[model samples]
Target chain A: MANLILLKEVGEAMNKAAIDAFPNECCGFFFGHEVGEDRVVQEVMPVENSKEGDQRRRFSIDPKAYMDAEKHALAMDMSLLGVYHSHPSHPAIPSEHDLKQAMPWFSYIILSVEKEAVKNTTSWQLDEARKFKNETLKQL
Target chain B: MAQVIIPTPLRKFTNSQARFEAAGNTVQDVLKALSTQHQGLKTHLLDENGELRSFVRVYLGDEDINFLQKGATPIEANSIISIIPAIAGGIV
Candidate 1:
């Protein structure tokens, strides 16, 4: 329950999405089937950012898209593990804004992309105090 | 009039009620009124210029306001409105 096991292809697809949207932030959803004490990811579903402007520094997922992701996960017999976004030319770190917006029981992954290439990536989740704390990632 | 469902995390500002009622024919009007009714909510829901914060998403039932008329989106009597904080973050 404490370890997040990400599939190799899912990470690659996430990196590709980030690279494709270089210079602007890209966002998406990840879902997985639950194993005994492990959440093995199954797929990555990209979502369109609905933020009006400042795509380079900010990102917002369309609420409609969020609902769609839930339905899609349900159809695939997977539970939505969390969401992911790319930070072009930045490190994979969650911000104060992220801390304020995050809800409980969801994982958040951030991919660092620099100059059209993906760099480091990290994942976080909200603790009991509703603060985002780093979580371990096992890339398979 | 419409019923605004405040998300769970924001319920501390709403006396822990899941929702509250405000009178208005449009989403913006109801939101503005709700902010007035809740003293400390003005800043959380709106910026200094009275604009909806970029991280705040308003939904009329299941549809986002952005795809519709935005804040100007009209509301029917007793319609349900949901205010959700937009997910935000990036590379540090």
Candidate 2:
């Protein structure tokens, strides 16, 4: 399986975003290159949690934001490798809803936030059956 | 005919092909042609009622189709359509 190569600063930024969002979930896109089977993240851009209902349990990015992210990635000469989101007060594990909403191509990074601190961070990739399998995270 | 830029997530359905030439005058028509060519991708882009899925975002050049006429948005032979899957998830 291809592992995710996340820059240390990128991980910290995502953790900070998760902390800033607090009880609510934070979401964003990862812009980078795919080196062979590994996804190497070069940049992370945070987006608004546009989910209508309680944001504490769920998060969604507006379609316009997605378009903007694509444009941004193109300008940077990078591809949209995956997404990063926080699970406030929950574990860094893929939920059933995550599996249902996920696409097999992108890596999924989940951060567990409790109170104002980030507790855990994990990456996942969907298998052929559309089920999320733990993806190795290599911090550089 | 419009050139559809397949996002990486849906590339598997297209046999890892990134670009596809589909024939249609509107976003819906082009998507129909695309799905017809790759039947495995239909369920991902459309719902049971054949409506575009909420999580699937279609763009004509730099503009999102929803900002215009949505699936009814018109296109030309040289137009480039991009399919971007909305990135989202949660604890629940």
Name the candidate that leads on lDDT: 2
Q: Model 1 off-target regions past 4 Å?
A: B1-61, B64-85
In order, the interface RMSDs are 4.1, 1.5
lDDT of 2 by residue, B1-92 (tens): 68998887788899977789987889999999999999999988999999999878898998988899999999999999999887667887
- lDDT (10s digit) by residue, model 2, range A1-140: 78899889898899899999989999999999989988889899999999999999999888778777867876788888888999998999999889878987789999999876898899998887878889889889
Candidate 1 residue-wise lDDT, A1-140, digit = tens: 37788999998999999998888999998999657766677699988877787888888887777656756765776777788998888788888767777766678999989876898888888876767888888899
* Model 1 accuracy (lDDT, Cα): 0.81
